[model samples]
Target: MAQTADDAKYLWQKKLDNGHIRIGFNDVAHQEIGEISFAKFPDNLTEVKLGDVILSIEGAKAVSEVHTPVAGKVAKVNVALKDHPEYLESSDEDKNWVVELF
Candidate 1:
């Protein structure tokens, strides 16, 4: 079944820009994980040595870890998303990226 924007929880896509990869969890993650209550991460902009636990998100049901898909420097974390966790559950692709690497 095709998921219309309204029917989907989140979406993610890759971009080729200076070796940076953006990752976001779609509405499905939000719906499955429930409200996000907490987040854990290494020290700011810590070098992620490939396949490391970069961060973790705590939802109402469980805490999930966000891994470093590839070895790179953690460029930016979406503080906005951290403040407004519900956005993770309802945003379209245009507004749903959780992290960016450089």
Candidate 2:
């Protein structure tokens, strides 16, 4: 089911690392959806607007579309998730980030 950005945690900014901004689902979203099993991220990107669907996540409970919490140029994507999506469940929130923005 599609819901407005207002009702979802969708995505959030993790602390700056080497100046790159990390983006991922907030704690509430991870807890609500359970363990993540798969993820799909954007390809050949330039920029993203606020609320843009940055990636799609499939969890133990349900599939969800995660949106960009802020607008910025796309730096790179976490391609590692394609094979080990379980990283999203890491105790370290930074490991769960799906996108990096500049």
The TM-score, computed over Cα atoms with residue i paired to residue i, of candidate 1 is: 0.67
* Model 1 ranges with Cα > 4 A deviation: 1-13, 16-19
For all candidates, the clash counts are 4, 0
RMSD of 2: 2.5
Per-residue lDDT tens digits for candidate 1, residues 33-76, read: 78877655556655776556655667786666666556666677
> Considering every candidate listed, which one attains the maximal lDDT?
2
Report lDDT (CA) for all predictions.
0.61, 0.74
Give the range where candidate 2 is weakest over 10 consecutive residues by summed lDDT: 2-11
lDDT by residue for model 2 (1-102), tens? 833333245556765847878886566776777898888776665698887877777888877777777778888788888898888777566577788888
Which candidate's TM-score is highest?
Answer: 2
Mark the regions of model 2 whose C-alpha exceeds 4 Å error after superposition: 1-10, 15-18
